[model samples]
Each structure stands twice: as C-alpha cells, then as structure tokens.
Target: MIKNGEEKPTTNPVTAPYRYEISAEQCRSCDRCKKACKAGAIRGERGQAAYLIDEEK
Candidate 1:
C-alpha cells in the first residue's frame, strides 16, 4: 500500500500466531506458568479460579 510518497512493505506479515488458551479447571495454579510468562498474559481469580490469557496485553 502506498500513502503520500511512502510505500508500505507487506512482504512478510503476521498470519496466524499461536492462539494460546487454557481450558477451564485446567490450570493447576501452581504459579510456575505465571513466573514463565514474560508478557503477563496469564491471569486468574483468587484460589482455584481458571486462568485465561489476556490477549489484549
């Protein structure tokens, strides 16, 4: 695509990255994953709440 006097390069773009998700009652809440996640996408409620990835983050 071109705009003004510049052209955007679309040779290589993100197609479909991994849609990571954890099923309900799947996470053991071991806190191991929380430590591993650098993006801090993993989130959950208190106690044994099921953890879900915050993709917006």
Candidate 2:
C-alpha cells in the first residue's frame, strides 16, 4: 500500500526532559550562574550565602 520511496509514520515519539538545579549550600553567590541563566530561573541576593531556583521557569 506504499511506494518504494515512501516512509512509515512514527506512532510514538521519544523526548528528553529538561533538567537544571542549583546547590544552595555549595553556591558561592557569585551571581555568575544567575547572569548566565537565560530563563531567569535563578534568584537570590548578591553576596548571599545561598540562592533559589525556579523549576517552572
């Protein structure tokens, strides 16, 4: 029911989940990671001991 060059459609597709995390205790609060984050997921005060991460971002 198909031509020689025809291709079959995929019924299911595989996807990789997006993953990111920040270690509050290990973080030096250098603000480097916050600046690099394009999604603005990282939030905290400058020179603070810890930072926060927004998973929904």
Q: How many clashes show up per model?
A: 0, 0
Return the top candidate by TM-score.
2
Best by lDDT: 2
Displacement of residue 21 (Cα, Å) in model 2 is: 1.5
How far out, in Å, is residue 40 in model 2? 0.9
TM-score of 2: 0.64
State the lDDT of candidate 1 residue by residue for 7-36, as single tens digits.
644444556777887766577776667667
The alpha-carbon deviation from the true structure for residue 2 of candidate 1, after best TM-score superposition, in angstroms, is 23
The Cα RMSD in angstroms, rounded to one decimal, for candidate 2 relative to the true structure is: 6.6
lDDT of 1: 0.71
TM-scores, each model vs. reference: 0.57, 0.64
Candidate models: Cα lDDT each:
0.71, 0.80
